[model samples]
Target: MIDKRLRVVLAEDSVVLRDGMVELLGARGCEVVAATGTAPELLAAVAAHRPDVAVVDIRMPPTHTDEGIRAAVDIRARTPEVGILVFSQHVETVWASRLLADGTAGVGYLLKERVARTSEFVDALRRVADGGTALDPAVVTQLLRGGQRHKVDALTPREYEVLELMAQGHSNRSIATLFAVSERAVEKHVAAVFAKFGLRATDTDNRRVKAVLTYLAESGS
Candidate 1:
């Protein structure tokens, strides 16, 4: 269950789907501050409401192609604080890479059909709203398959595992629990991954996101 109530702006073109989502979010204790059918409307609603998170679709009015994702990119640029969760039927890695280009927090990409449970969907949304990642496993797989192996060759097997889990938006503590290791061990692996990727501590950028971006870019996603 979500720890706190979240205000949301939903952007899905289908009336049926949009209504269903609004109801679903309401049931899950998220207020749908605005529900829109077009990219422009979505952007306007987001700006007006300043919702905690925006659930966006990839296609909408006009061309019915990439308008939603473009609006999402704009939202990221304009309001870095509001989280964005790209809930789409398609898995366009190019779009995913573009959305995460800066690798700032509060971003997620999940395939609609693959989100079989409402709890899972809400959990992903909550994670993104909390400035964490929630990438779909399929999205992760495609990125890994397309990445150039040589780029990540420097990572030891364990470090590579940590990187993969990191790509999936797992926290260091979560990774430790999954591996049955101490959190400190996980931190060491994460630091190692950062060093290997040439990422350094900086106030302006999130090193974790940079590491993930490097993984995505090197994977050729």
Candidate 2:
């Protein structure tokens, strides 16, 4: 099902793990374009090669905190075509959603433990590279804490789907296609969602982005 060879950029702080991933993916039929262990390297390597996907560790470089997540965000903004598969020790739902919180071109958040399942891990890379979405089991588990009501109260099931896609910065046309509706219908739903969230302002984009960010912040997802 993979149409073309996938190019991967990997960033993990552990030398051994980074090397192992590079080898594992390469053996699995992906091209390992570059690899690094620092946040700066992640940014620079991604900028330089613009690979098809980036597999980044959640912690890296200075502080080894959210550097990989932050790098993934910046990389997403710069290289929209590149998919980012974030590897984390813990289920960082907020950051994971934030990474996917804009344009669904190619985004994934997987925990490190899953790497042993080579088939599944490579499948995730392919899905992301092919414009699909994948989230770690743990990530989804964490998101469940937000509960259905967090969005269900303010949006129709369909509109809530649109809203979550919108949270990923998907456009009206994209959301429309996802829901098998017209752009106009998507617009209407968006309007209603804005109204429900009190985000129907001239600063719609900013407010909407902030609203989702607030939701994620509050729910820790």
Candidate 3:
């Protein structure tokens, strides 16, 4: 079940946009406790108010080379309970990887274009607040290359497809149906993928997620 309207803190350099965001979020029943620009201010706002989630823009004043990412990482380290949503106008997989490294729920790296739809943006915020990782589909595709590793390139083409679909949250049976294969065969392909990545599929469901994330990391690397 979803929790109560989340307490949020936003970080964006644009005055007009930030004010609009606060109003939008407030209408959706979210309590925006703090708002600021710059990395240090963001870190400070989160620390002072302790919001349930943080929405940060990648670029801000003074050497915006991933300052938001660093601030978000620090916030995550200091306050693991707080969810983080990072938006960027450009593809920045380097920062994306840092936010996703923990595999913890309630973290996202969404492209700014995806936020034009008020409902979609609010959904992303709610997803993060509820401990779900909702990485933008585009970000997922872009970051897939960083997941590449020495041996991961050896995975069969179909296996790679399986991994991608799995990352999209499809089950073995679902994948099998999509590919017109038996569930048993799908399971075997999944196993082969795990073995190729040297990942343990011990927990069944968790293994699928792990394998997909691993493949993304390797392919992107």
The models' CA-based lDDT, in order, is: 0.84, 0.74, 0.77
Candidate 3 stretches greater than 4 Å from native = 1-3, 146-193, 196-221
Candidate 1 segments whose C-alpha is farther than 4 A from its true place: 148-210, 213-221
- Candidate 2 stretches with Cα past 4 Å from truth are 1-3, 114-116, 141-145, 149-170, 174-182, 190-221
Name the better of 2 and 3 by TM-score.
2
Candidate rank order under TM-score:
1, 2, 3
Q: Number of clashes in model 3?
A: 16
Would you list the clashing residue pairs of candidate 1? 146-219, 147-219
TM-score on alpha carbons, each prediction: 0.73, 0.72, 0.69
RMSD of each: 6.2, 4.8, 7.5
- List model 2 lDDT by residue over 5-52, tens digit each: 789888999999889888988888899888898988989998898888
| Candidate that scores best on lDDT | 1
The count of residue-pair clashes in candidate 1 stands at 2
